[model samples]
Target: MQDYLELFFNLIKQPIIQAVLCVIGSILAAKIADWIIGRVLSNLANRTSSTIDDNIIQILHRPIYYSILFIGLGISVKAFSLPEVLSFVLLGLFKTIAVIIWSFALFQSFMHFITWYGRQGKKDNVF
Candidate 1:
């Protein structure tokens, strides 16, 4: 048993293995985030009087997932010990993608809120 445990530990010490584990961990984290937003947060949002909160939560789910995924990927890339320039570029790319995704989500959520507010105003004859 000790021999097997030692072998497993040795294998896990490899950079490639570590990188793969990081990627897998990131995916799992993203999925957990999705589940939380979909199941737990959705339930909370549903209890609210306004649907805007629900829509905002739904919009945020993907951005949050992809942000976590990109961060992990960036770490994995660094684990490979590539040239500094290459690592910098790859990390920058991941950071850019995360920013873009979050920006898009924020824009979408804001638009949804604006539209909902407009509808409410119309219903109240405040328009």
Candidate 2:
């Protein structure tokens, strides 16, 4: 058991393994940002009254935000083979994108939900 454990640790110490882990870590970070944005969007949508805006916001923000962030992260992580400073710079940009995505997703959700419910109110009170 000790021998096997040592062998596993040694393999993880390789440069290639580190590179792979960095890429996987970046992807996992992207997924986490995705989840956080979705949750924030849900909360904002529930709070606001404009269902149309909320829906439209969601429609506009959902895929584009995630796609851009994820693609950017993937491209940035691919730069791991570059200089050390470049890798760190790429990570910084990736984090910025994650923040942007999170903020926009929340904004879009609140806007679209407000639009949706606001229209619903108009219909309901028209009687």
Candidate 3:
């Protein structure tokens, strides 16, 4: 039993196994996040009159999901102990992707708010 346990630990310590576990954990986390965003927060947003909450939820959903995925991928790659140059390249790529995802979400949310404000302005005869 002790030998079997030691063997199991050794097998799990392999880089590939670590990477796979990281990826799986990240995916499961992303799914749970998505479900909460899609169901719970969305329901709460529906109860409110302001569109801000709704816009925020919408804008954040995909970025948050993909960010989790990227983080997982990054961890998985790091586990492989790749060449320094390759590791840095992957890190840079993930950073760029995260920035793009966040920027796009911000832009989308800003546009949504602007549109909502415009409608409000029209309703108030301010424009």
Question: What are the models' TM-scores?
Answer: 0.91, 0.46, 0.89
Clashes of each: 0, 19, 0
Where model 2 places Cα greater than 4 Å from the true spot, the runs are 1-5, 25-84
Q: Which scores greater on lDDT, model 1 or model 2?
A: 1
Candidate 2 residue-wise lDDT at 84 = 75
Candidate 3 or 2, higher TM-score: 3
Give the lDDT ranking, best first.
3, 1, 2
* Superposed Cα deviation of residue 45, candidate 3 (Å): 0.5
User: Which numbered prediction scores highest in TM-score against the true structure?
Assistant: 1
lDDT of 2 by residue, 27-48 (tens): 6766776666666765678687
Q: Tens-digit lDDT track for model 1 on 28-99? A: 988998899899999999999999999999899999989989988988887777789999999998888888
Order candidates by TM-score, high to low.
1, 3, 2
Candidate 2 backbone clash number: 19
**TM-score of model 1 vs. true structure:** 0.91
Q: Tell me which of candidates 1 and 3 scores higher on TM-score.
A: 1
